[model samples]
Target chain A: MELSQAARLDQAAEVLPAALRRRVLALPAAERARIEELRLRGGRPMFLLGPEGETPLPGTEITAQTLETVLEMASRSSVHTVLDQVRNGFVTIPGGHRLGLCGTAVMDGKTLVNLRGISSLCLRVARQFPGLASEVLPKLWQDGRLESTLILSPPGAGKTTLLRDLIRCLASGLGCPPLRVGLADERGEVAAMAGGVPMLDVGQRCDVMDGCPKAVGMAALLRGMDPQVLAVDEITAPEDVQAMLQAAGCGVRLLATAHGETLADLDRRPLYRSLMADGLFDRLVLIQQTDAGRRYTVTDGEGRPC
Target chain B: MLKLLGGLLIMAGALWCGVSAVERLRRRVRVLEDLRASLVWLSEELTFRRSPLPKLLEQLARERSGPVELFYREALAGLSQDPEGGLQQSWRRAMVLQLDFLREEERQVLVEVGKTLGRYDAGAQAQVLAQAARRLETIRAQAGEEARGLGRVYTALSLAAGAALVLMLL
Candidate 1:
């Protein structure tokens, strides 16, 4: 089945507490499909955020008991299985749906040992959009060599959505040769690999390493998969950039996304200074989505608009 | 002819009582053994497969029979359907309503494990299960000894009581 068709929002609703499950079911099918997230906090009203905005779910108040049950169900009655994800404040279930959690942090001398008394929960829907990266593909290919690209966007601007398609199309010979694409999905969001299988279609040539740090995953991809192109989402750490540089030096193309509006955002960061000074990115793409519509702008590494 | 018939009738009744007493003892022992074996399987399932409670229980319910199967089926139904109550409460209810083989104390051990079953990570849950499995082994041993002792005593007593009653009647 097509990955987009297979990534169902109902997967999240199915694991919800029974009382809220009814409310989720009551939502119109189209609205349900458009939901970006479902947030529930103990003693607070449940809310669903979509393209338009937040809609408070009436008569659906999250209770402590209910929140505990949701965590139990999401973790499959075994907290150890999802302990690493839990420590990171989110757990990825089957079908690539992620449940964000916040609770009393059990700390052992500054390191978070685990979570207890969990009270806040958010279920983010991971989805795929076919052909969403068409506008940027041409800009990335020049002289028969695909340029390493970096996607830029603010929160809720569809950067991950666009990047997912970019990885899919590029992996399937959309622009250059059908190269081996290695995805370092730290949060399992890009490829949504569940049980070592991509829930979303990332093309036939894509190999994914999920649930690891971007830096570690990038290195593993370089050494293990020997991929020609490596993709990672949300590169925020120094280690991630170092790995990207190392992989690029090895002749592996890099695709990375970050929380930013433009190249100016990267220039402001001390961590990405050397990366920008090196002219590492061949093509820079900025995505903006507002009430008007979604727009994609392509630029060169020197910040000149294409 | 009438006295002879009466004596034979008494002897037949005594033998039946002896056999019936032995059967109940054997059933109790068999139930304890089944419970221990099922618990061993449960530990293996948790250690190796790490399936969720409902799925694991469903699998066991399908493959097994007798008292252990009943417990798994009841626990599965309660867990899948009970949203109002915690799994511990559901487990207790299922034990009370469905499983008849276990003593109240032995059943309490299973219920106690349910209290932490889904509340923590897999490693912790597996640890709890392994302890419960060990406890189950101990219970099974005790039950075996009890059955061996009780089976012989009850059978002999029942037969002797029947025979003495027949003599008094004569």
Candidate 2:
């Protein structure tokens, strides 16, 4: 049956298996648009379609009430368990759409007990922006060895998208002995796997462990996987800092990302604090979106002229 | 005339009881509503940049004034004391203590989240969060229903007490 966009979205919502449904419904308008766009680009089905401030679900506004409902539910569940639910929370109804979450935390000292009052949510529609990585891969590798690099950008700046493409490029071996790549996709953002298999083709040479902690995963890769380079995303935690240091000590090149609009943003984070104190990373790559399109600049750890 | 005077006194006592009951119910509702509202704010803070999860949780633990505040306190206590033991252990222990207060699915989700965080890999962590989110939809739907049910019960009880007061006056 040919489904209309709204119908497709409705069907997707209906099949979202309960947990994902709430997250999707709670997404802000802008985030929903992004998800729709990604889904269309990826040729995946879109589970949600409607104008801003008007969705099918009642009381599903991107307000405190809805946010509280979502968080309360999350708090009752485990972080890992809820993340998995978020992964499966959508169906490729027609435009390959997906939803993501952002929220407040209830902390006990340094531990996150529960996430409450979810505020912003992004619904990225998954699209396979193929050939995007080809341009960047050549610049990232030299003499067949991967460089220790850091990808920087603000949220929705295509950092994960770029990383995903890079993983695929490395995994394909680009006509060389396949690079054994270990992707520590902490948020399932890079690989987007379903049922233990990658929904996206990250490449045959890649080994993924879905829902594992980044620090532990890096250590494991170094000890067991024997990869030439280790890649992870969005490193912020102190433990993550410790893990990355351990990886660098083992001589494994590293690639990662942090939330920042510019180099200055990088300086304020604990991750940056470690980077300066430890000098662990070799190159810092800055990605920016200008009218000319996506631009890239590679600099040394100090942000000095390369 | 004496009998009528006694009847009037009894009616006044019943009226007082009715008003007090209504006030009590209203207060409880307000407390629950406030808790719900605070939870929403806390959720938003967690996702905001420049604010890490641990810091936010600690703030909430210190400032919260409800039953959930204890959960926050335990989490903060666990995290600050053992910064090296790993965040998952503290979260699990604190969350488990309040597991009985949560819905069954929520309890299961928390348990799984703790386990997932213990592993090594971003993909795994993402998957765990995704799964927990899925279950959360169900839990939210059910919670909404539960909240509504409680509201209805309060209303009914208030109405019944008011009616009893009126009968006593008659």
Candidate 3:
């Protein structure tokens, strides 16, 4: 069967495996050609064409049929699952595609149950953008070893992307000996792997526990994996703090991310506040996006410019 | 013949109530399923990549469509409109909005989720999740018992009314 236009786009970014990409792209020329044309033009053009090219783009255009098909195809080809179906309009695909669905949602108090007449879907494809860690690696390895680091960024600022690249660099030993890395991919975002193997490189030296809760995964890694460094994504819960502390206590250097626009943003959050107060992380890295590109800034635990 | 007419009326009423109750239950189940799916999505987005929590939360809020959208919208509004209110205040407002829509058990689960997001600790978050799961189990058991009781009552009422009508006719 022919892959949908969204699958084609995912293939281009290498989010879809090579074998699957070929299978998806190898359909009859007419269908493949249509998706290729749309892929070349990007999300906006494909969106403009609408499903079956019958009508103008509605406010929310993803249909239930489209979502179900895409999801089923992705799941069949990959090891990921559908984690959540948002009532307002989104289906959280396991390998990190937040397919924004457009529909009317039925609500019971604060919780939503069903979405009817899905109109549009924005499939946010997840990719591990490499080459970022090279810039920050030197700063992190102060004395010929990896230092405990904290990555800070606003949403979509690419903290996970950078961390993934860092893990790859450290694990593969791009230039140096491979380092054993433990990745607690609590959300299945980092590896974006289908089964056990990662769709993204994320380095050869890293052992990943996908979809496991962060704390349990971390403790497991410490006890079982014996990783040289421990990495996790977004720390917001107080329990996550305790886990990080526990990992630190185990003598495993920490690498993680937190939400904040600036160092001052850290002061307002209790978890970040306590981590900062305790001086848990040896180095703090800030990422900011600009028209030029993503800029990285290094800082100490005290939030001083490094 | 008069007695038969009364029996028919009673049967009609019972069927009507039965269908209505079934429909209500179905709707509730659908809502719960959707909410559960959304929660899974929330967990994925929050834990997947290392996006900053506030930024991620704001993005989620912007992308929110269902009932929880309001919570996200309020969080976004609080962040943008009341920058001085601080993260805690913004978070609290969002949680409050969420609490309004959630069942008591779901609300408790969210409170713990909020706490986990506020801090960067994984173990603590896991603990809260385990506790919430336990509470959910209790709620499910109670709901099951209540549903069973309701079903029995419905069956008894239908049978008793049918029997009484037959006797009156005889």
Candidate 4:
């Protein structure tokens, strides 16, 4: 079984200093479950970010040593191994929790070489809801094959969450026939792969290529894994679009997400507009943050609401 | 006859003491040499494979024996025992507890290396290890020279003292 939210919180807290871990664990169960991120700045009190807002834990100020310990523990006592990710501004720990770092940058001729003397860290907790896309899944298939669907939302609107669930459902054959899914998990977010095995449940039929650029990973997954569907998260680069177009040419279904609120919002951007113009996506799932919860709306490739 | 036997026993005891002292010196040199060799191996593994510390230590313990192997095993154990203390503390504690035969300066060189083992990039770690190995090499050479010179002196002194004592008794 998947770990409970409290257990995930504990796992994320394992990287924290002992005293701070205790303080975080001491929160009420209600507050613990609602925590979305853990923020720590050297010389400042620790803060817990949730849907309500930031809640500071009194009497728990961060130190430089605390940040060092967190980095050491998160990297499994090997910061050098994850130095590339650290240079990129975040490090994804086991279980897919990402630590966004703020620190002194070591640059070499306009290129970021390393991150040193870390001052603040924002640990974004990764959560999975297995059946989140069940209602939206039926509309995404035509005949026996799944449509090449694009998940659209602004940041923090649960785009990755829905995409993850959709991959799990499709790969596990929860509502449709089992499909072989090759996930180009560029940031290690989708599968949270650790030691050649996924830390999170990405279904039995999923093969993940993690911690590589999405463009390279997608092309590799297409050529090597021979997957029925190629899934990637947060399409942001031109190379990613070219790779998707190449994969589409091979008759492989594609599943991807982009940063936008609506179809019109995506069309405004030249990159996304080119993707839409190529007719690469067969359907779009627009996610909106409603007062009660998230709302997922499905539409055809031409922006006709389904 | 009794007098002769007593003289022989004194001579034998003196010889044993000399041998033991020489052996202790040789052992110190051997320990230093072994530690240097192990550092070279560590440097190669870290530089080429970028292997993590725990796995590298486990491999090291398996390949070595005596104080060098014990040192690595103790370091690995310390990691599991009190992880919050981190690798440096564990490494320093391991050296202090297990490698008592080493001189303070020799151990300090290793402690310096431990401080950076898991903290930096492979290139940096390899550079530190290389520096440590070079330092250990210089120490080992001096130790070897000391052992050869001091061993001969200890043996000659023990033999001369034994002979003088026997003559006086007679």
Q: Write the per-residue lDDT of candidate 1 for residues A95-195, one digit (tens) a residue.
A: 66789999999998988878878889998887778888877888887788788888889976887888889988888987557878999998887787766
| TM-score on alpha carbons, each prediction | 0.85, 0.48, 0.50, 0.91
Per residue, candidate 2 scores C-alpha lDDT tens digits across B1-170 of 87567666665665666556555544444434444444455444433432334656667777776655776678767856653344567777787774345545566766676565423234445455556655665566555665567656655665566566556666
Docking class of 3: incorrect
| Candidate with more favorable, higher lDDT: 1 or 3 | 1
In model 1, the fraction of reference contacts reproduced equals 0.49
Off by over 4 Å in 2: A1-80, A83-112, A115-120, A175-177, A302-306, B1-170
Displacement of residue B127 (Cα, Å) in model 4 is 1.6
* DockQ score of each predicted structure, in the order shown: 0.39, 0.02, 0.01, 0.65
Q: Candidate 4: which docking quality band? A: medium
- Model 3, stretches more than 4 Å misplaced? A1-8, A12-81, A84-120, A175-177, B1-170
- Give the winner by lDDT: 4
Backbone clash numbers for all candidates listed? 4, 85, 35, 0
Worst 10 residues of 1 chain B by lDDT: B82-91
Tens digit of per-residue lDDT, candidate 3, span A114-224: 554444444455544566688887788766777789999997677887888888888899755578999998767677655577766778789898666788888888889
Give the docking tier of candidate 2. Answer: incorrect
Worst 10 residues of 1 chain A by lDDT: A1-10
RMSD per model, one decimal: 3.5, 18.0, 17.0, 2.6
- Descending-lDDT candidate ranking: 4, 1, 3, 2
Residue A3 C-alpha lDDT in model 4: 77
